[model samples]
Target chain A: MHWEIVVGLEVHTQLSTRSKIFSGSSTVFGAAPNTQASAVDIALPGVLPVLNRSAVERAVQLGLAIGGNISRRSVFARKNYFYPDLPKGYQISQMDHPVVEGGSLTIQVGPDEKTVRITRAHLEEDAGKSMHGDFHGMTGIDLNRAGTPLLEIVSEPDLRGAAEAVAYAKTLHGLVVWLGICDGNMQEGSFRCDANVSVRPLGSGVLGTRCEIKNLNSFRFLERAIEYEARRQIEINEEGGTIRQETRLYDPDRDETRTMRSKEDAYDYRYFHDPDLSPLVISEDWIARTRAAMPELPGAMRERLVAQYAISAYDAAALTASRATAAYFEQLVAASSGEAKLSANWMMGDLFAALNRYELDMAHCPVSAAQLGRLIVRIVDGTLSGKLAKEVFEALWQAAGEVDAIIEARGLKQVSDSGAIAAIVDQILAANPAQVADYRAGKEKMLGYLVGQAMKAMKGRANPQQLNEILLQKLN
Target chain B: MSLTLLDVKRVARLAHIAVSEDEAAIYQQQINGVFDLIAQMQAVDTTGVVPMAHAQDLNQRLRDDIVTEPDLHEKFQSIAPQVAEGLYLVPQVIE
Candidate 1:
C-alpha cells in the first residue's frame, strides 16, 4: 500500500518593527539578557499593553500583498499556559479572529504550480529565550525577545509532500521579506516554522492523525524533518501500529524526531478574549493607504518579467525569487540596452554561479549589475566570444577592472577581423594535414578537431562562428 | 451549578498548586457562592445584548514604532530572585 504525506506549516515571522508588539521595548536581537524587557514586557503590576500601530500596518500590508482579507474586528485572546519563559503565564494571541485571513500563495515545485491555502496570519507577541546550556547547571532566561511582534501565518494541509512544503515555505519567506514585514533571517530566528505532518493511504480522502513538529528553524531542516517524520509514520503503520497524535521536537544532530508531549499532557488552554485589549477595528481607508504604499509583489513581478522580457516562465520565476534579485536583473537588462534574453541567461547562469561560489546573496554580490551587464553586452555585441567572456568574468570576480578596460588590458578581444581569422584557419589546415584530410574524407566530426586547433593557434581570440566558417571553407 | 470539593481539588492540581483537604473544602464553598451569583445572571434572557470583552469598549491605543526603553537589566534583575551575569537564573528547565 502506498502512503501519502500531508503537511501544513505554521510560520512565525518576527515583524521588523523597532519596538515590541504590546510594549515599547526595543526588539533588537543580541541585546543583553532582560535589558530590552520593559516593565510591560516583564508583566509589572501596573503596566499595560499598548498595541503598536506599525505592527498592525505591517500585517495589513502583508494581507494586501497576498490579497488576504483584512479583518475589521479582530480580537486578541489570552492563551493560558504554564511556561517559565512566558513572564505573564499567558500568551495574548488570536483564537477565533486574526488580522489577515484567507490568503493563498502559489509555489512552483518542478513543473507543478500549487497554491497553498493560508488559513490566517495572526499578530501575536513572542516569548523570551531560555538558554539551557549557558550556565553550568541552571537555565538562563533572556527576556530580550519577549513581547516581540510575530505574525503567525497558518496554512491548510494542502501540501502533499516534503518538497511541496519546502516550496511553499520558501515562497512565503520571499513574500515576507519582499513586503518588508519581516527580515526573513532564518539563522537569527526571525523566521520559524512548525509543521503538522501526517501520513495516510494513497488516494484516500480521510485524513490521518498528525503530530506537530516544532521549531524547524532552517529550510534544510524543515525538509529533512518532514521526510523523516513521514517515514516514521509510514513504518509504524506498516508494522500494524497506530500513529500517536502528539507534539514532537526535531533533533538536527540526531537527524530524528523525539516525542515532546502527547495528548495526555496537552494543555487545555482556557482561551478567553483578553479584556485588557479592545477589539481591533480596521477601516477601508487604512487598507487603501497600506495598499497604496505596497511594493510590487514577487508574483506580479514574475508575470511582468515574462511579458516584458519574453523569457520562459522558469527563467522568470528564478529571476523574481527575491525582490533584490529581480531588481538587479532589471538593472542588468537596462545596462545591456534591453537585451533581456542575454541578460537573463547571464544573470541566472554565470553570475548566479559566481555569487554561490563566494557564498553571497544578490544583495551583497561583489560585482555590480552594471559591471556584469557590461561584460555580457560585449558578448552580445561580438566583442568577445562566450569562452573568452567567462575568462573575463573570472577576472572581474577578482576585482579586475571594467569589462572594456579588461578586454583592452588582456588583448582578449574577439579576432573578428576576417583576414586575421582566415590566416589562423589556413595555418591550422597546413599544420594539421591528417585532421584536414580526415575533415575532407567524410569524417564530419574532424571539423571539430580542426576548429579546436584553429582556436588554440589564435590564443582563443578567434570569433568561434567566423573561425568555423573560415575553417570549413579552407578545408573544403 | 456549584463547584464541589472534588472539582476544587482537581482545579488546584491543574494549576500545580498544593491545596490541603480543608483548604479545598473552603475554596469550594467560596467558589460555589460565586457560581450561584453567576447562575442568577445566566437566568436572565438578555439575548440581544452583544457579548462584551471589556467594560470600557475603548479601542486599543496605538503606540508609535519607536524604542523608548533603555537597558535596565540590573534594576530589573535586582527584583528577580536569581541572577548571573545578565541572564536571570532559573532552575534547570529541560526542553
Candidate 2:
C-alpha cells in the first residue's frame, strides 16, 4: 500500500533583542551561568515582567514580511508546567491571540514552488538550560537563557515529505535572518524546529495520529527524524498495530526516534491569562513603520533577480538564499563586463566550491569580488579561454597578481588568432593522417579528437572554439 | 460545576502540594463553593461580549531593550539549596 508523510513544523526563533522579552536581563548566549538572569527572570518575589519594545517590533517585522496580520491586541498566557529550567513553573506564551496570523511562505521544492500556510507566530519567553551528566548525579540549572525573547512560528500541515519540510524550514530560516529579526544560528539554538509527523494511506483526507519530534536544531536532523518516524508508523500500520500519539526525541547517534513521553491525555496546562502583563496593543502606525523599515523580502528579491538579470528562477533562488550571497552576485555582475549568466555560473559553482574546500565564509574569501569580475572579463573579451580563466581565478585567489598581470606572467592568455590556430590544426592533421582519412571518410567524431589534440599542442592556452573552427575548415 | 474529592486531590497533586485525605475532603467542599459561584455567573446571557483577560483597560507598558541587570549569581546562588561552579544544582530531572 502506498503511504504518504505529512509534517507540520513549530519553529522557535530567538529574536535578536538585546534584553529578555519580559525583563532587563541580557539575552546574550554563553555567559557565566545565571549571571545574565535578573530577579524577574528567576521569578523573585514581587518582580513583575515589563515587556520589551524591540521584541514586539521584531515580531511586527516578521508579520509584515510574511504578509501576516499583526494582531492589534494580544495577550500572554501562562503555560503551567513543572521543570527546573523554568523557574516560575510556567512559561509566558501567547495562546489565543498571537502577534501574527494567516500568512503563507512560498518554498521551492526542486523545480516546483509550494506555499506553506503559517498558522501564527507568537512572542514567548525561552526557558533556561538543564545540563545533564554533571554536578555529581545532580543536574545543573543555568537560568541565563530564561526569559529570552523568542518568536514561535507555527505552520500548517502542508508538507508531504521530509524534503518539503526541510525546504520550508530553510526558507523560513533565511527569511528570518534576512529580515534581521533573528540571527538564525542553529548551533546556538537561536532557531529550532519541532516537527509533527504522521503517515497515512495515499489520497486519504483524514490524518493519522502524529508523533512530535522535538528540538531538531539542524535541517539534516529534521529530515532524518521525520523520515524515520514516518517509516516507523508505516511499519506499525502494516503489522496491524496502532500508532500512539506521543512526544519523541531524535537520537542522531542511532538515527531513530524514541518516545520521550506518552500522553494518556493531552497536557492539562490549565492555561490562564497572566494577570501580571496587560494586553499588548499594537497600533496601525506601528505596523506601518515596521513594514516600511523591512528590507526587500526574499521572494520579491528573487523575482527581481530573475527579471533584471534574465537569469533562471533556480539561479535567482540559489543566489538569494542569503542576503550576503545575493549582494556578492550583484557586485560581481556590476564589476564584470560579462554576461550575468556567466557570473552566476561561476558564483554558484567554483566560487561556492572553493569556499567549501577552504572552510571559508563569504566574508573571509581571499579573492575580492572586483578581482574575480576582472578575471571573468578576460574570458568575455577572449583574452583567456574558460580553462585559462580558471587558472587566472586561482592566481587571483592566491593574491598572485592582477588578472591581466597574471595572464602575462603565466602565458595563460588564449591564442585566439585564427592564423596561429590554423598552423597548429595543420600540424595535428599531418601528425594523424590515419585519423584525418577516417574523418574524411565520414567519421565526424574524429574531428573532435583532432581539435582536442590541436588545443593540447598549444598547452591548453588556445581558444577551443577557434581551434575547432580552424580544424573543421582544414578537414573539409 | 463542582469539584469532586478526586478532582481536588488531582489538582493538589498537579500543584505538587501534599494534602491528606481529610484535608482533601474539606478543600473539595471549599473549591466547589467557588465553582458554584462561577456557575451562577455563567448563567448570565452575555453572548457576543468579548472575553476580558484583564480587569483594567490599560495596555502593557513597554521597556527599552537594554541590559540593566548586574551579575547577581553569587547572591542568588547563596540562597539556593545546591550550588557548585556557578550553576544551581537540582535533583536530576532528565526524562
Candidate 3:
C-alpha cells in the first residue's frame, strides 16, 4: 500500500528591527550573555511591553508582498508555559487574529510548480537561549535573544513530499530576504522552520496524526527530518501500531527524529488574550503608505525580465532567486550592452560555478559585474573564444587587471583575423592529409578532429567558429 | 462547572505548587466557588455582543524601534540567586 507524506511548515523569521518587539533593547546577535536584556525583556515587576512600530510595519510589508489580508485589528495573547528561558513565564503571541493571514507562495520543485497556502503570519517574541552541557549540571540562561521580534509564518498542509517542502521553504526564504523584513540568516537563527509531518494511505481524504519536527534551521535538515518522520509514521501504521501526535526533535548527527514529548507530558499552553496590551489597529493609510514604499517584487521583476530580455522562465527564475543576483545581471547587461542571452549564459554558467567554488555569495563575489560584462563583450566582438574567454575569466576572478588588459597581458586574445585563422586552418589541413582525405571521402565526423588540430596549433586562441568555417571550406 | 479534587490537584501540579490531600480538598471547594461566580456570569444572555479582549477598547501604543537600554546585566544579575559568567544558573531542564 502506498502512503502519501503530508508536510506543513511554521517558519519563524526574526525581523530586522533594531530593538526587541516590545522592549527597547538591542536585538543584535552575539552580545554578552544578558547585557542586551532590558528590564522589560527580563520581566521586571513594573516594566510593560510597548509594541514596536517598525515590527508592525515589517509585518504589513510581508502581508502586502504575499498579497495576504492584513488584519485591521489584531490582539496579542499570552501562551502560558513553564520554561527557564522564558523570563516572563508566558510568551505573548497571537491566539486568533494575526497581522497577516491567507497568503500563498508558488514554489518550483524540479519541473513542477505548486502553490503552498500560507495560513497566517503572526508577530511574536523569541525566547532566550539555555546552554545545558557546560554549566556543571545546571543550565545557563542568556536572555539576550528574549523579546526579539519574530514573525511566525504558518502554512497549510499543502506540501506532499520532502522536495516540495524544501522548495517551499527556499522560496519563502528568498521572499523574506527580498522584502528586507528579515535577514534570512539561518546560521544565527534568524530564520527557523518547524515541519509538521504525517503519512496516510495514498488518495485518502482524511489526515493522519502528525508529529512536528522542530528547529530545522537548514533546508537539508527540513527535508531529511520530514522524510524520516513520514517513514516512521508509515512503518508504525504498517506494523499494526498507531502514530502518536507528538513533538519530536531531529538529531542530524544520528539522522533520526526522536520524541521530545508525547501526549502524556505535552505542554498545555493555556492561551488567553493578554490584557496588558490592547488590540493593535492598523489603518488603511498606513497600509497604503507601506505599499507605496514597497520595492518591485521578485515575481513582477521576473515577468519583466522575461518580456524585456526574452529569456526563458527557468533562466529568469534562476537570475531572480535572490535580489542580488538579479541586480548583478542587470548591471552586467547595462555595462556591456551585450545580449541578454549571452549575459545570462555567462552568469548562470561560469559566474555561478566560480562563486560556488569559492563558497561566496554574490555580495562577496571578487569579480565586479562590469568586469564580467566587459569579458562577455569580448566574446561578442570575437576577441575571445569561449575557451579563451574562460581563461580570461579565471584571470579576472583572481582580480587580475581589466579584462582587456588581462587578455593582452596573458597573450590570450583569439586569432579571429580572417587571414590569420585561414592560415592556421590551412596548416592543419596540410598536416592531417589522411584525416582530410577521410573527411573528403564522406566520413563527416573527421571535421571535428581537424578543427581540434587547428585550435591546438593556434594554442587554443583560434576563433572556433571562424576556424570551423575555414576548415570546412578547405576540406571541401 | 465545578472544580473537583482531581482538577485542583492537576492545576496545582501544572502551576508547580505542592498540595496535600487536605489542601486539595479545600482548594477544590474554593475553586468551585470561583467557578460558580463564572457560571452566574455565563447565565446572562448577551448574544450578538462583541467579545472584548481587554477592559479598555483602545489600541496598543506603538514605540519607535530604538535600542534605548544600556548594559544592565551587572545590576540585574546581582539580585539573581545564582549566576555564573554573566549568565543566570538554574537546574538543567532537558528538552
Q: Show where candidate 2 strays beyond 4 Å.
A: A423-446
Arrange candidates by TM-score, descending: 3, 1, 2
Query: DockQ, in order, for the candidates?
Result: 0.77, 0.87, 0.89
**What lDDT is reached at residue A115 by model 2?**
92
Chain B TM-score by candidate, in order shown: 0.88, 0.91, 0.95
Q: CAPRI band of model 1?
A: medium
Q: What local lDDT does model 2 show for residue A92?
A: 98
How does each model score on TM-score?
Answer: 0.97, 0.95, 0.97
Q: Label model 3 with its docking quality class.
A: high
The residue-by-residue lDDT of candidate 3 on A136-204, one tens digit each, is 899999999999999999999999999999999999999999999999999999999999999999999
Q: Which pairs of residues collide in model 3?
A: none
The candidate maximizing lDDT is 3
Clash counts per candidate, in order, are 0, 0, 0
lDDT, candidate 2, A1-476, per-residue tens? 99999999999999999999998888888988889988999998999999999999999998888889999999999999899999999999999989899899999888788999999999999999999966889999899999999999999999998999999999999999999899999999999999999999999999999999999999999999999999999999999999999999999999999998877744679889999999999999988887888888889999999999999999998899888889888999998964699889999988998998999877788888898898888888889888888888888888898988999999998888888988888788889999999999999899888877887899998888877777887888
Tell me chain A's TM-score in each of the predictions: 0.97, 0.95, 0.97
